[model samples]
Target: MIAIYPGSFDPITLGHIDIIERGAKLFDRVIVAVLSNPSKKPLFTVDKRIEQITECTQHIANVKVDSFVGLTVEYAKLHHAGVLLRGLRVLSDFEKELQMAHTNKTLNHDIETVFLATTKEYSFLSSSIVKEIAQFGGTIDHLVSENVAQDMYSKYQNQ
Candidate 1:
């Protein structure tokens, strides 16, 4: 089965990679989709985010990285992916994910969302936090992949 892991992924964090690595093992194909939300101010552009994802996930076989500027369900339909992979960090994430899962299911009844609880070590890791650290000139070497850290630093410096 093909699974679509959709996220803004402003900069691909190690937590995100952990989920991708785990999710990749479950499905024949895994698509790491970078979501484009016009309402939010994302530090990284769609192209930049896609580039980071590509660089970070280059070693993962059977995994493809791409970007979508519409609803995730719509993207899933376009890719013929029947499963949506989500990683939950804690209870705080459950409610929101539950709502999204239901909404996606309503949009595409055939599409099902599978939630994977993040590993304890990565439960607190997120792109927002990584960006915040990098923005404040703090080290994010542990939060994101080396390529991601470098890209984020480059973006931060340019801004």
Candidate 2:
């Protein structure tokens, strides 16, 4: 079945990649849909975020990268995706994700929300954490892909 893995993916952390890779294996197609939110100032533009996700997920044959600018359920419907795939790292994530799933269900009863438990190693990894480390000149090579690390470094170097 087609599943949409929707997120801001500001820089596509390894945690995100882990979810995408695993989701790709479970679904016939896993679209890594980037949410285009103008209100939040993201380090990378929507186009750049899409490119980063594409680069990181290139090895996963069933993964596709795209951007959307509306409710995630709407995006899933527009793309004919039957599932909304999400990753759960901890109880806090569960609380928030569960709420979103319920909200999406209310918006579209036909679509299902599937949650995957994150790998132990990446339980604490997140895009915000990765960006925080890079912003402080800390090593983020272990938190994200090499390409993403370089991109983060390049973006922060000018600041």
Candidate 3:
């Protein structure tokens, strides 16, 4: 029942929302886990990303958004989640996800990773791309939730 949807979610885009909505429909509970990594230059902080995801998914009864700062498998274990959910927008995501799935399986044999194909409409929408558009004063209203778009615009302006 409880499935963990883990991702950096630097800026939760429409693609992420699509995956969460689709995954939530199948699981009793869906945890939208925001991953934290200090190495990469992220546009938004973990707290901000969590707030965006929480705002976007608040209407979904079974979805909960939270942030994690360690191994995904460890987070899943602590959260009592037995399933790991992923979104595959294209074939390019396969190799990395496969490796991660195997590693997670090695860490927790009982936990499984389920990959869901993103809807065609959202297949081209990535958080990075949305951030680029937002940073350049381009409208990303359709690429993310209304709240996310507004937050991105405000954040970019303040920068």
Candidate 4:
């Protein structure tokens, strides 16, 4: 079955990669869909985020990277995906994701939201934290891939 993993992915972190890698193994195909949200100012543009995700997940044969600008459920339906994959790193994440899952259920009963618990190593990892660290000239090599780390480092270098 095709699964859609949607997120802002301002700068794809190891935690996000963990979910994508695991999701790829469970589903026939996993599309890493980046949300083109305009409200929040993201460190990376949607196109750039997609490119970064593509570069990071190149090792996974069944993973595809894309972007969308509408309801995630609609995007999933358009892509003919039967599942909406998400990752939970903490209780706060669970609370927020659970509400989204229920809201998504109301929007489309055909699509199922599946949540994966993040590994212990990435329990505290987040894109915001990654960006913060990078913004302060701190090393983010451990949070993201080497390529992504370079991108982050370069992005923050100018500021």
Candidate 5:
């Protein structure tokens, strides 16, 4: 069945890619949906995030990249996706993710939220953490895809 993996993906990290790769194996189709939020200043634009995710996931034939601006459940409905895939990295992540899953369930009972345990290697990885490291001139080569790491370096070159 089609599954929608929704997130800001401000700059997709290796952790995010890990989840997408695993999700693709479980679902017939996996759409990496980037959320378009105007409130928070993101390192990358929605379009750029989509492009990065697309590039990183190109090897997975069943994975698609897109952006959305409204409720995630609505987006899932629009795509006729039966599952909303999410990644759980730790106990803290479980609490927040569980709450989001419950809230989404209230909005749409048909779509199920599935949580995938992040690979142990990526348990402590996140886009924010990567950006923080990059902002301070730390090596993020191991935190994100090579393309994403290059883009991050390019973006922070002038900062």
Candidate 6:
């Protein structure tokens, strides 16, 4: 079944890639969707996020990259994705993701939200954390891919 893995993906981290890779194995097709959230200012644009995710996931034939600006469930419905793949790294993530799953369920009952526990190595990883580290001149080589690390470093180069 087709699955939609939606997120802001603002400078997608290895943790996000890990979830996408794992999700790709579970679904017939996995769409890595970058959410264009206007409310919060993101370091990278939606298109940039899509490009990064595409570059990182090119090895996975079943994985496709896209961007969205509306409700996630609606996006899943548009793509006919039966599952909404989410990654949980900790207890707080569970609570937040569970709430979103319930909200999405109300929006579209046909789509199911599947939660995957993040790999142990990425349990403490996140895009924000990576950005934070890179912003303060800390090395983020371990949290993001080489290309992503370069991109992130460039963003904070003048600081």
In candidate 6, the residue pairs with backbone N, CA or C atoms under 3 Å apart (3 or more residues apart, or in different chains) clash, namely none
TM-score on alpha carbons, each prediction: 0.96, 0.98, 0.96, 0.98, 0.98, 0.97
Residue 71 alpha-carbon offset, candidate 6, angstroms: 0.4
29-71, model 1: which lDDT tens digit per residue? 9999988899999888899889888888888898999988889
Number of backbone-clashing residue pairs for each candidate, in the order shown: 0, 0, 0, 0, 0, 0
Question: lDDT scores for all predictions?
Answer: 0.91, 0.93, 0.90, 0.95, 0.93, 0.90
Candidate 5 lDDT at 67 equals 90
What's the CA error at residue 109 for candidate 3, in Å?
Answer: 0.7
Query: Where is model 2 more than 4 Å wrong at Cα?
Result: none
Error in Å for residue 97 of model 5: 0.6
How far is 93's C-alpha from truth in model 2 (Å)? 0.6
The sequence of per-residue lDDT tens digits that candidate 2 reaches over residues 1-159 is: 999999998888888998998898899999999999989999999999888889898899999899989899999999999999999999999999999999989999999999999999999988898889999999999999999899999999999
lDDT leader: 4
Candidate 5's residue-wise lDDT over 63-105, tens digit each?
9999999999999999999999999999999999999999999
Candidate 4 vs. true structure, TM-score: 0.98
Question: What does candidate 3's lDDT look like per residue over 44-102, in tens digits?
Answer: 88888888899899989999998888899899999899999999988888888999999
**True-vs-predicted CA distance for residue 47, candidate 2, Å:** 0.6
Model 5 score (lDDT): 0.93
As a TM-score, model 6 comes out at 0.97
lDDT at position 100, candidate 2: 92
Give the Å error, residue 138, model 1: 0.6
Query: Which candidate model has the greater TM-score, 3 or 6?
Result: 6
